[model samples]
Target chain A: MLIRKPADIPPSEITPRSTYVERRRFLGKLASVGGVGGVSGMSGMSGVGALAMAAMSWRPGDAVAEVGAGSLGALVKSAHSTNETPNSLHDISHYNNFYEFGVDKAAPAAQAHTLVTRPWTVRVEGLVKKPRQIAIEDILKLAPLEERIYRLRCVEGWSMVIPWVGFPLERLIRWAEPLSDAKFVEFVSLHDPKQMPGQLFPVLRWPYVEGLRLDEAMHPLALLAVGLYGDILPKQNGAPLRIVVPWKYGFKSGKSIVALRFVAQQPVTSWMRAAPSEYGFYSNVNPDVDHPRWSQARERRIGEFGKRKTLPFNGYGEQVAGLYAGMDLRKQF
Target chain B: MWAGRVAKPSAAWLARIKVALFLACLLPTVLLALGVYQDRLGPNPIEVVTRGTGEWTLRLLLITLTVTPLCRSSGWKWLMRMRRMLGLFAFYYALLHLGSYLWLDQFFDWGAIGRDILKRPFITVGVAAFMLLVPLAATSNQAMVRRLGGRRWLRLHRSVYLIAILAVTHFWWLVKRDITEPVVYASILAVLLGMRLPLHRWGQARTQAAAKGRARVTGPAWPRNP
Candidate 1:
């Protein structure tokens, strides 16, 4: 009998969110019973089975108070499972690599509370017909918000499944109406040293900036996320607004985004500028193209004990691979 | 009197001290093992194990480097006996550190491990530091020392300084941005290396001068030929 591969299984036949989450808890219980033997216990299941069973069980009833006032969690659509379990809320929020906050994985969670995201304004400029600094509130009203669960693969060889609430980046880009010459979309993050203590040290030329080619930015998979896990975004997790490029490394999805500029040339990203050899501008999640410092072939999912092989374009190849069609990913990476 | 007592520790006392030091050196590994057995290494236990082992290796390397200078400064010659054990412990921790990387991180994937050692600068320096320690550890025994002779053995062990430098560099290069830990280690190693330069020469010169004074006390009355 021919077994159907997970990728080949139609969305209609996929497991329900409730069943998927229940199976995950069951597996998690089984794993704990195996008593911390690393990934061996979790490895009993196939990688794809584990990925689909990895969703966090946060529902509408769990800590509604933590959702924060005026949160967009209510507006979030029901689960459209990305076929990958998201990192636990604790793991997703705690284990971050936001250099603007500090270098340690825990620093962002500790230090990002000081960030004032309420009065945030996102400036849209450079090669756009209309240059404006839209108020955070006004930007929220610009387009209808939608929930999307996307896989975030970090360049440091770790990954997370994040349930993001936002609208397509193309909506905002279209609203700005880019000039004919605009070939790239540059994202600039808030650079307040007072709010972000890590800015006191020159980790990377601050006001951390990242960029994407215009087509990549306009892709349907690209999201301008305002919240995660059906709640207001935590400051550490890039509160107010941030980019979510599911196919690229986590660093490429700049946090605490304050500006979006359409440029004629490729913009210098913070990581790419700091270490040109280690981080390329494109920085797509390609396992075959190893990082100069570590192999990108495998990534430790945030909550899992074992590492799983990294997928091409972070398992979104069908949705996003067409953008990089004839290009040498190894060279570009 | 206390200084004199420190200078001339009895054989039994030294033996007891050696055993205590050995157990003290083993404490981190013991606690780490307990943590593993009890499942208390937090969410990322492999990382905890890897980093803990790596840190112990670096700490032991620094401890090994301190032996000679400490012996010179305090005039406690017996302290030199602890050097071999300290060096061996450093190698033990280094082996555990590499084992964690090879077994836990790389899962004995030779191709991936080889690529990491070759491509990553930090890993390269780390591998270099570990390789340099192998010879020092191999010749640490009395029989090997006798075979190699004192002069050759001393020369071989001096590479520990280089290993310390490389080990510190490996750590410094591994971090993404905040380097407070590696910086502290670098500062300590720098001072240790510096203390050995003129102070070490002064120590040798004083020993030679004392030897000359002893020769004068025991020399023949008639100083015939010059």
Candidate 2:
């Protein structure tokens, strides 16, 4: 009966010396460039410039400018950013629930290297007025990438604060120009088993799909993330492109998206198809409404000990509460 | 009864093997301790520990159940000596699994734990399995066996089969998807439980044969008709 304590990471180890210095250097560079508004001047920048400014203000301690085949030019700090500290990049990348690589938490990091992110194109079709295939390169430059630190609450009773670099999904939806009749948006992940071994298994139907109400998709809080921690997203963390719906369960935010379909009807998501009784269409984070298998009232935040009381909508009630104001969360959940 | 007798190991050899088996049974806990000490349990150490202890509990329970059939088929009577120890070790791991949930996962929050045990079917079955193991573990000693008599003791201990089933069901219900691990455990348990059916029938046949033999020697209580 050896009672050893959980790993006690020192402050220095949490943010490595190199990362700390790099963050300081980036902040100093932002200050030296007087023409470009510094952190405070981000509000003054207009259109995509504001987003670029926000990207410039992004201070991932160990920010890497280049990711895979592309360079993430500048990331501005988003007004939507959560004040909570983001989990370490190691923990964030190493521990994931991306089933496309494998079901095990550690499986993605090990098996995701085989995935080919480049030469990727997302098809935006269905009820959209202007249906088109958007290449990954063009998607990255579609809008100024902002650093949005959001609380990602998984359906499995675990939570993490992630600094995601991407523009709002609204931007992409606008580009696609969905028809007025489009009620829901469906995201289709890559279905190539040759690239994603997990696809070989019929785990929730291949080409993992997720959906959102057109309004939820248009919410400013819903982001199409390209990178995390100011660096290009690792393959395991859904590299190339993924959606981030902060208020909903992490599974609602589809990863490594290959297509966006604007549909007139509510699309049957992968998880909903897998277990309709457990997962619902909305999948918003409601602490009161527990998952059928486990309690959702409390959640264990990554890198922290003990559980904390889970907040309704993961504490994003202020922003997204209106969307579900009259709806029955329990019924939807 | 199914196979020819195998050579029994020397007492000294048996003792050494028992010690090795004891250490082997304890290895999972040791590795988990090392993981904690070295901080290698990853970000979610509690989860790792919880799952590790629970998996070992199920495995040890299945291994303990294997001894009877293994000994019967292999003609290794010496293995029977290890069954109690193995069963006890299974209970030991069960205790650790429950301890981790209560102390680490719930932090002795009885209200939360109670709600989980009552509300969640998985936790309910898991707690039920552990509760049933308590009586078996208590009566595992020679004294309790002697006091209760072999027949009653055996009947009481038969509950282990139910406990094993409950443990597997608990695991089956808890997994979100990817039931491969639970399915494997359940299959092993199914095979172990299935093996007992023939042995039970054989025992029943033997008892009937013994009773007929006694009647033939002692004569029928009532005289035969002319």
Candidate 3:
């Protein structure tokens, strides 16, 4: 009897950057030369023989770029960030939590690349001295981009440690120069129905909106990430530019942002509007404050099997706990 | 009496159908095992197992609901014999779904599980639905049905409709955005429940008419036509 254990193949290793595209082309030529029998023989007549044959027939159309590999900056070490092992680029690319592209966790990974990020402009308005439309390129030049490894905790009980490349959001806020009356900062995402299919349905109000206290926005820990893991941020991971508030839930960090408004009154966010009780405006990662669906006490880190105990403020309690001082997290959550 | 005269299904036929139903019910579990063994459950195996079992549980429940309407409309009275088996299969899948969540997903964290059931609306409804299934599954046999008379047995089983609603609601609220799948399931359940109303009366009338026709054809001859 031939006993064969299925080989554990890391997708990142199998399909790295441009290599996967080249391999697909090579496989296509090979398949043309010889069909199923050749595939079987090449795969050593293993249990995965059929898969090898299927792989040969697979085209390289919709070729996904492997992001988060640029060595533009030295790795960042922050007291707030944990030393936990980061999830692989492949897992980060494929296993997404972005709902703009689609509801399924994997949907954004597959669909978000179609989104246009280049030639993007953001309107900085509301309670500012100069309300200007700044190009994304100019936004990148607003401050020198640095590497910052942060742990992102999703409200859905999953977390990921990502090495992001961006400057402190405060720099941009400082540049915008909010007036004294500016109490809250509202962020609006791109609202193209044709590109983001999820927006077509009434699952959520379009132009996915999120907000933060003006003070929270100006916090040094708040980041407007342009890239991840030393490379240009993948479209799925919110390319061009996106907010990265490590202390809050992943949804709080709006993606492909198009507008920033400094408002007097607190803004109602997309999720907050959709289900007020379930998602609060201040979606701070509090393990004690469970979501209406699941416990936040523990979170499954991407690429890992076992779950780790969730930290208050996603392990940035020292930095962000002060922002919510004297406030009841249970009610806010 | 019409019951004895209707001709009970042969023991061998019953045995064969039971075996077939058993194997058919086992198919999903087998495929799930094969999938796990093959590492085909995508990135999150626990999630795949959890959702897969939950979906199967709902599907089997719907299938069990279909059996009554199917038998009534088609006049395949013998189909009634399979309803208990189908119901048990549904219970079995529900058990697997719960087990997958408890063991695989939660790692048997009883306190957390308890908290989730109390806190989460979806989990609360799902737990209620599964709990309601327990008594019905336990009393599925003839002895227990006889122990608690037909009316009480029927009243207990009628909770299946409530369970179906809770199960559907459980699925509906869990999803972040896409409601298409839950809506489809809810529609199927609605049709199934709808059949039990006016359709039930129509089916009963048709069934009685068919039985009377059979009675006339196969003779009782006692008070015939008098």
Number of clashes recorded per candidate: 1, 6, 1
The lDDT leader among the candidates is: 2
Stretches of candidate 2 exceeding 4 Å from the true structure: A1-71, B1-6, B214-226
Residue-level lDDT tens digits of model 2 in A1-333: 122222233232345324543554454334323323321123344546634554565556444432222346666766677656676676788899999899999999999999999899999999988778989988877889887778999999999888788999999899898999999999999888898999888877988999999988888888999997777899999988999998999999889999999999988999999999999999999889989989999999876656899999898887788888789889987
Better of 1 and 2 by lDDT: 2
Q: What is the interface RMSD of each candidate, in Å?
A: 5.0, 15.6, 11.0
Evaluate candidate 2 and give its CAPRI docking class based on DockQ.
incorrect
lDDT by residue (tens digit), candidate 3, A74-166: 544443344444555665677777777888878998899789988899898999988998898889788887766678888877777776788
Candidate 1 residues B119-203, lDDT tens each?
9899999999999999988988988978987667777888888999999999999876568999999999998898878865764
Model 1 docking grade? acceptable
Q: Per-residue lDDT of B1-226 in model 3, one digit per residue for the tens?
A: 5554344567786788789988999888777765544445555655776788899999989998998778666665667777888889899889889887786568889998887888888999999999999998999898897898866887788889999999999999898766899999999999999878886565467658778885333322111100
- Candidate 1 residue spans exceeding 4 A from truth: A1-71, A75-81, B1-20, B34-42, B142-148, B177-180, B199-226
For candidate 2, the per-residue lDDT at B29 reads 79
Best by TM-score: 2
